[model samples]
Target: MSHPILTEKTVLLNANVKNKEEAVRLAGQLLVDQGCVEPSYIDRMLEREQSLSTYIGNSVAIPHGTEKGKKNILRSGISILQIPGGVDFGDGQMAKILIGIAGKGNEHMEILSKIALVCAEEENVSKMIHARSKGELFSLFDGVN
Candidate 1:
């Protein structure tokens, strides 16, 4: 019983978090709630962040588990959290969009590339940040590949 990579149920809109850690937790928790990964995966996500920032340019951050954490994944999935207010990712990086991913095997590379293509355009990132509803946010990733 594997879940879809991304689903409307996993898209959260208008989220408000005090910091990047909290934001990451919310994003990772969505994956957990959707049964994409085990509870331990969230800790690994934080560990990854500590080692290297996942904050890509254009006010977006993609957080995922470390290599060892992959074993905790139940299936491939993505969870999106839109924070209109934004959270600080340190070193002057503020991320309004948080994408948490859990990929089985090499699916993560595909997922990362797909997400990169969609997020390459600044306008798309802006639209995602200001999305009024979960459907709006979810639709932005539709047909992403």
Candidate 2:
């Protein structure tokens, strides 16, 4: 990314979430704590999930707020949840990585594009999914964005 959308604090490793909804909320809350978005943003994120699937393959799912929920955004930022056992993102798509994003404008697409680009390579995605530490995750993303 031209600027960082995610940081070490925004990444969760071996997180404990029962399902997709829980995962989204956990990731969204991280963004909220970071001052990136309002608490309401998580509701909008779930709304998006209901209307359209965010699953981007490679066991990754990108969840973002709906157009109506844009008002809740305070800044452009991204949060990542790494689930070692994977979560079912509906439709039989097992998502091992759940990224919750709240962008304050066109930054939304920019962040999504960056993540998509990085995850486009199966090898890179695998590295990210299996990264043992925050430093390792940062190293994987630093090379691409």
Best by TM-score: 1
Q: State the weakest 10-residue window (summed lDDT) of model 1.
A: 136-145
Give lDDT tens digits, candidate 2, residues 1-145: 2446688888888887788889889989999988889999999999999899889899999999999999999888888888989989888899888888888877777777777888899997798789999878777666323
Whole-model lDDT, model 2: 0.85
Clash pairs, model 2 backbone: 1-145
Output the lDDT of residue 124, model 2. 79
lDDT of each: 0.90, 0.85
Say which candidate scores most in lDDT. 1
User: Per the 3 Å backbone cut-off, how many clashing residue pairs does candidate 2 have?
Assistant: 1
Candidate 1 lDDT by residue in tens digits, 44-138: 99999999999998999999999999999998999998988889999989999999988889899999989988899998998898888887888
Q: TM-scores for all candidates?
A: 0.96, 0.93
Looking at model 1, residue 49 earns an lDDT score of 99
Measured with C-alpha atoms, the lDDT of residue 31 in candidate 2 is 95
